[model samples]
Target chain A: MPELPDPTHETYYSAAVNEALDEELARDPAVVLLGEDIGVYGGAFGVTRGLFQKYGPERLWETPISENSVVGMAVGAATLGLRPVVEIMFMDFIALTLDQILNSAGKLHYMYNGQVTVPMVLRTPGGAKGGYGPSHSQMLTNLLVGIPGIKVVAPATPAAAKALLKSAIRDPNPVVFIENKRLYPRRGPVSGPDFVQPLECAEIAAPGSDLTLIAYSAMVPLALEVKKGFAAEGGADIEVVDLVSLQPLDTDTVFESVRRTGRVLIVEEACRTGGVGAEVAARIAAECLDVLEAPVLRVAAADTPIPSSMDLEKIVLPGIPDIVRGVHELMAW
Target chain B: MEPKPIDLLLDCFRKMLLIRRFEETLSDLFERGALGGTSHFCIGQEACAVGVISAAADTDYIVSNHRGHGHLLARGLDPVRVFGELMGRTIGYCGGRGGSQHMCAMDHSFLGTNGITGGGIPVATGAAFALKYRKESRLVLAFFGDGAANQGTFHESLNIASLWKLPVLYVCENNRYGMSVPVSASTSCLPIAKRAAAYSMRGVTADGMDLLAVRRVAAECIAHVRSGAGPVLLELETYRFCGHSKNDPRVYRSREEEARWAERDCIVLLGKRLREEFGISPDRLESIRTEVDAEVEQAVAEAQAAPSGDDRCALGGVYA
Candidate 1:
């Protein structure tokens, strides 16, 4: 393996995503892109800015505003040996594509009995921190978590964003890559182009002994911030675990952390009901009930439509204060 | 029109006859409770399947929908294995995982038939995109019912295929009904082929009952697609003789209409052509019938004796 670059050099999350796409397109001729306004428009979020000019129209094909057919097209192309990475502008718009993504792309391999594989990636921006309102600002990772055939991955940092996307593009099955709009502009150190993060593992963002704080995507950085505040005040040492891969979640790391800390708290930007935190809490209750010091707690967004106003959005979405308060409640319990 | 070679006509006739017999046997089995689950039969639409498939190259790809047994049979897949799939045996095309509506033979380049109405349209368009991107000469043919033309995917996929000029042929088996609701009731357009013109693509309607006519139209459309003139929507005006499925009462249509369609039965028309045009004797036709009946009987017997799919492997192929 080649050595990674120095950690001092940093790049934005969106740039890291662009770098991964550039490298994969150059690496494999079969990796083509299909989406609405992804070509000359440089993508809705600018993640695919220079790719259109670099790869030309044949590689970076623009599509109409048809989400269902675009995804269906990707699944069809993938079966025929092209690794198409489709961009569904916002994660909210994925509702228009559930049939193709869940039924066709997800079930084709099993339905065909392995005669064909749909090697494709659906990259969409999700999460609530953008204040994009009810339709666009949904952290819909919960919707894709329990699906069997499709894999869902959310990256917290620039490095994880780059590495996880590379890994998702290379996976032989359909992978729904959820990118948090809030994390797009955040800068962090990314490894070399050869680095590919494992799709079925969690990373301990920070280590501690007092409590375990589990989060993912945009919530990971917030959890880390809460951990840092506690460290500065010499409060309870909280361990932050980033659940990068939502589907096929790395429960071993979570259970181990819960056992060590004896207290656990799950945080997410998605609604509390039917969120990834609910599944994690249930798993901890089922498997690590004996080791827990208190009930597993969760800090998630309010169970209502995310508002557009900053004040209302702040109250509805989980923030640093909510994580701190949850930790305090867990410690008190 | 000029006649195709006698030998080729004979082969097409045999394939069409086999599909007819296969669907008839399936309908019988379904009625007897010997076969479980629903099956959509292409009893009267055999020529559309055989004619279009025969007009294409062996390497060309095919995407089919629910009423797809005839399509698979015409593409030269084993009847015994297809029967085994319906019988839930491990020797089937999908190892008994996919039922009648969802069987794939990738080695033959026949993608699996979809249960969704217009599900295979965009997939076929995408496959054509892949072939074109790789600079291959092969084209993809997608089959769907007239009801599917009203689906959003049909319109969306046609636009993309036309814009990119993908090498694909969208073959609509306009059997005039979408499971009891007639095309006139569901679709806004007069003929589904006219909807193709909205996408700036070639649209043609063929006489689906006549095997030679369908073959001629399919040949032209296939040649047009293979030559990279973008996708063509070829509507085969056909009808179904039986109920949509085993449980369908088919109260929507009358016996008079059914009899009228039966008069133009594709099998009978091809038999007449073979007797008059090709000089094939009735005794020879009877022998061919006997041969096909025996083949179907052997297939049914072998499929019945085949081992049931193992329950332990139920979750094996969910991922790559």
Candidate 2:
């Protein structure tokens, strides 16, 4: 694994997103931010806090509760040589914008014979936290990952969030940048403008020979915690991998790690049935089947609605123990 | 002003004729299994497409719906390329990846036809926002059916366009029926233009059958929108001579209804205006029609002869 470069600054995950938007807005006159309650109210997660005051209403537009139109407007604005970053308050509301996202924005380049590019980022908060109920909390990255066109990036750390978002905004293709609500308050090292992780690659946080534990977004921290506990308690020597870009997946890095470790455990906050973990596991099995000693396993949320209660929510979502258990079981083979 | 110029009238008449002949050709070709997919023909509503599109500047943008062949052609898209797309040829606009409803020519500022009803409204609004943000003089003309006026996106798009005072002309081609349901059945007799008041924007209705009348209203609306007064909702009361698509038998309407709309055909109305008002001889109009037919024939032959788009690299061009 490459040595981790020390970040130049430390800030909250939400602050990192704000910094990325601030940088992009300042850098380009055509870059605009539009969403519901994002202007004076900042944002649902306050990611755009003070941006409206900073950039003013012209660049920072406060829109009505029109999710489909918001996304559609971004798609249109992008075609006209403006980079637009739209926000949907909750990830689940993306369902309302699927026509604009999947059919229009995602297929535009390909369908239009590459005459246009949708240089836009759809930033929305997802994952189970704050007991926001079923409508608000959903790791619906899988819904977008299945799409052929748009890039899907779920940044795990504040540093990654800040960097990937800046990259996503600049990216010519449409990008869906998913943020975890739980990570908003968490503070982490965020680099300056020059430091940005590529939106297409995965990072191996910890190196090990025993097993490869893969996760993204909120699950990455839990996977890292599992790695720390295993090292301290003299369990398996687990390597942690963050599959950042889910669509243009970093399968090469995963295939290399799975080949070395001979075991894999994919984790995700989404449901197990058709979650991104299932895709990662399937890819590993297809490519690393010869080198693998055991079947590729996945630790994902149960195929049920996330309960409102904290106790039920904890059980419904995969935790640190679930990652540790999945790792242990994968190594058992 | 001085008498309407002969050259401009001829151009409008030629555009309407091209659309009418193009749809007529598609109808024959579709019956013989020459074309691949179903197409929505705008046979009688040529005046609406030609009139509004002609009023805009060359740099102005346009968003269209499924029945948008007339709109694209009237905006000066190459008929050969348009036909090539329908024929699934490699040289077609969109590389034949997008057929009739999805054809787009970025250079012409035609944003392509949307498959979903009212899907193009917000996109056109956004384009207008881009123009306004850049302080460009270019405006956007978004064309949809009367069926789309009832969609939530229609209202939401109008609201945003009005709020921002974007340069956009929202045109609703009220062809009376959406697929099978008439506008009267779907909503009240209150015309689609009346809904523009809810967004606090100027709304007007035009005679879709009369080419000169449609152009006059479109000219005024385009001027108002270009001046940044706000977006204008201009509803053109038109009719489609054919079914919603090739497969649609159009059992919903009667022959009497079809004949009534046929009497006020946009092409015939324009032909009378050109001959009676401009005094262009019938021979001259007949020669133009013959020339247009030949042009369409050549386009069809070229599109038919073009190589089939290879799907071996089907996954190519998805990302960039």
- The top-ranked prediction according to lDDT is 1
Give the least accurate 10-residue stretch of model 2 chain B, judged by summed lDDT.
B1-10
Query: Is model 1 an incorrect, acceptable, medium or high docking prediction?
Result: high
The lDDT for every candidate, in the order shown, is 0.91, 0.90
Superposition error at B226 for model 1 (Å):
0.7
> Could you give the interface RMSD of each candidate, to one decimal?
0.6, 0.7
Q: How much TM-score does chain B earn in each model?
A: 0.98, 0.97
List model 2 lDDT by residue over A48-133, tens digit each: 99999888988998998888988899999999899999999989999999989988889989989899999999999889995877
Superposed Cα deviation of residue A17, candidate 2 (Å):
0.9
Q: Which CAPRI tier for candidate 2?
A: high
| C-alpha lDDT of candidate 2 relative to the true structure | 0.90
Per residue, candidate 1 scores C-alpha lDDT tens digits across B234-291 of 9999999888888888899998999999999999999998999889999988888889
Query: lDDT tens digits, residues B1-320, model 2?
Result: 54456787899999999999998998899999988779999999999999999888878999999999999999999999999999888878888888998989988989888888999898899988999999999999999999998888898899988988999999999999989999899976478889888889999998999989998999999999988799999999999999999988889999999999999998998999888988999999999999999999999999999997776436688988
Alpha-carbon runs more than 4 Å astray in model 1: A1-8, B1-4
Which regions of candidate 2 are displaced past 4 Å?
A: A1-6, B1-4
